[model samples]
Target: MNVRNFSVRRSVVATVAAVTALALAACSGGGSDADADKPSGPVTVKVWAWYPSFQKIVDLYNSTHTDIKIEWTNAGAGQDEYTKLQTALKAGKGAPDVVMLEFQELPTYQLTKHLVDMGKYGANDLKGQYVDWAWKQVSTGDKVYAIPVDAGPMAMLYREDLFKQYGLTIPKTWDEYKAQAEKLKTASAGKAFMTDFGGNDGGFMTGLMWQAGSKPYSYDTANPSNIGISVNDAGAKQVMTYWEGMVNSGLADTKAYGTTDFYNGLGSGKYVTYLAAGWGPGYLASVAKTTAGKWRAAPLPQWTAGGNAQGDWGGSSFAVTDQAKNPEAATKVAMEIYGAKNTDAWKIGIDEAYLFPTATPVLESDAFLKKKYDFFGGQTVNDVFVPAYKAILPFSWSPFNSYNFNQLTTGINGAIEKKTSWTAALDTAQANVTQYATQQGFKVQ
Candidate 1:
């Protein structure tokens, strides 16, 4: 998907304005002694979120509680949400009390001080409830800035019927996967092959690099001054090389079509497999209405023999802003809604079309795993995803992430579109990223 498409939606602007007005009005309530003694009369907390699943929880909360009603506004897409959030933070006045932040953007917002440290309101204990990697996204140094809401455990999704038609086995290693792609190409006589590379969305490349233990930056939380870039690291080079090979070999289609195109192509059996996350199953099921009962889920192929078995693509966190009139009360409600075990809420949310949960306990629940999904031929999709979640490697994310990665992807796109050498394009990307980092006051090691 395009970065702009992922940002918050504009539909929530009215909701935000309404909530802000309510908050201001609540503050202006008559200052009688009894009113002053009252513990902050029912502050209407404003929340901005993207996922329909999260909205379900909010709906549940609103249904159950008369006080502290949450006024929710949907930000268009993930990318749009971040843009709106950054703009609000820069404007510094009308930001929402709670904002949904993508995991990739967590470090950027946290480091830039756009987000409040959730721990300040006794919400620190909430960290213990999620997986280590999920919790690490909003953590910097000794401070916790956000609460993990969901995780995107990586997996390989494929058409079982297509694989059988091509007489191919599910490849376990990257090399084997490539060979299978080639064979499928030959079998289909150039009509079908492996997958599509979403040139517009650079997130797939970043996730692959992270899964291979490559990071864009390293820092010392104790010092809060030291920083190092890993764009030129060996792992990153390997990732780029692999991507280049895929494009050059014609095993993967390098198209600008966003997720919609990718899903449509997959559903029509235009490709054999896709490297995706836990939420992908539901997304594909919805989009590939005609391909039901033909697809299946499998473990991701390894880059090398016996390599790390896990990877992650995307996830999100919830943060309470410092500007909230009743930070304590808002957090109390947030924790109760997000931190507590709400299986029914989660199932309802997922059923209503939000992605899977990042909460480990929820993943382990029978209700989550045993659901009969008609997509993927009734296969237990959760079974494949849960294992992948355990394999993700935790790394410290930096504030310079979005800028650096965008530049790198832009350079890559230029190279492919202009027929430039990979090495030269990557070298240019490295220099550009380093310069951008320096301008942001980060050390480029």
Candidate 2:
């Protein structure tokens, strides 16, 4: 699935002037019309996605369904695809029947009314099949915008050998985690930092803020022009301050993630722990092959002692675009493309592509939970991830996610370069996002 690339999905930020203009254009003139090119025969639903082995899944679907067929295309992944989708929306044409969208990016399209409400096509009836948090991600109140496909539940991936060598134990709380980071630095004689705080990755930083119970944004289609912004909330400040101290003291490195330096650090034993998500094991296995049996997965440290709150890093879904020639057929394709009922499709997704399932049947299957990995010395890593997945609290994303992430990336880079404090960085993000939202015609709450 190119899971590593998926894990490091980057934002495609437009300039404030361009974005504001696009928002105004999209809000007034795009995607609100009925399907204009309905076909007379068996429907061919055009789909844009980058899911691994998608052709096999499409073939399976085509072989069984006589009334509808999927015409799949990998337009691009993440930022590349988003840029194209935005352009298509602005032009009021050239969009596919359906498109794969990451959870965080869904709201941006929804704000422009470019995505269809799958609830009208019976998606609400399938809610019980998916994990609650995953369902929540594609829904707002009673509207279902997409179908849950996969999820990235957060956990701590550490070097077991290093933990033992440093006489350390898995931490149960963030305070204890900090103490252990300090201990690891001293024990390694400053040869290694505990982990890296990825300054350039807004998604990773957002996941950390989520784990700490930050409520950074709120927006809904019912009130598309109103948004609630609190990027500098107490929880966010606490998380940022915590990492800031660690980075400043050299207890944690501030390396940009997805770069060769960070990957090399993982393989070279320069980092003792990796705060990762459900798909992290596969990514680590692919990159740090030399550290095979030395790695192990564990629950993330709690902010409050004994708490089990968790956060997600990356996950995506299929949404029927408002430009679909046949909304019903497109909705069916979106809902069933990776559904629990499609075991053949899931075989390619889970077994071969290493996707973490959102469907409960697959997520809770004995085979999934009991499967062990040679990379983690045969540990049933799902045991750590399943709980993390189930424990995540509901989170709301802003419609201006691209600009929000850009602001965060700028602030984090400034902090990493010693030009500002992390707390100041977040405060700056809060101010910048609020102003941007207002500029885009949103009433900041």
**Could you give candidate 2's per-residue lDDT for residues 1-445 as a string of tens digits?**
2235633355555633464466655666544555566677889999999887788888999999998989888888877777787778667789999899989888877767778988888989888887677898899877899998888888999999999999888988889988998998889999888898887777788888899899998767677777889999988999989888888888998777888889999998899899987778888898899999999999999988889889888888999888887888899999888888787788788766678888888878887898899999999999999989988888888876777878888888887897578899888888888887777778888
Off by over 4 Å in 1: 1-39, 53-55, 220-225, 257-261
TM-scores, all models, native as reference: 0.87, 0.94
CA lDDT of each prediction against the hidden true structure: 0.68, 0.83
* lDDT (10s digit) by residue, model 1, range 310-417: 767777777776556666666666666655487667777567654677776777788777866788788888888887887787866655555555666677778678
Please give the RMSD to the true structure for each candidate, in Å. Answer: 6.4, 2.2
Supply the TM-score for candidate 2: 0.94
The residue ranges of model 2 lying beyond 4 angstroms of the native Cα positions read 1-3, 6-10, 15-20, 24-40
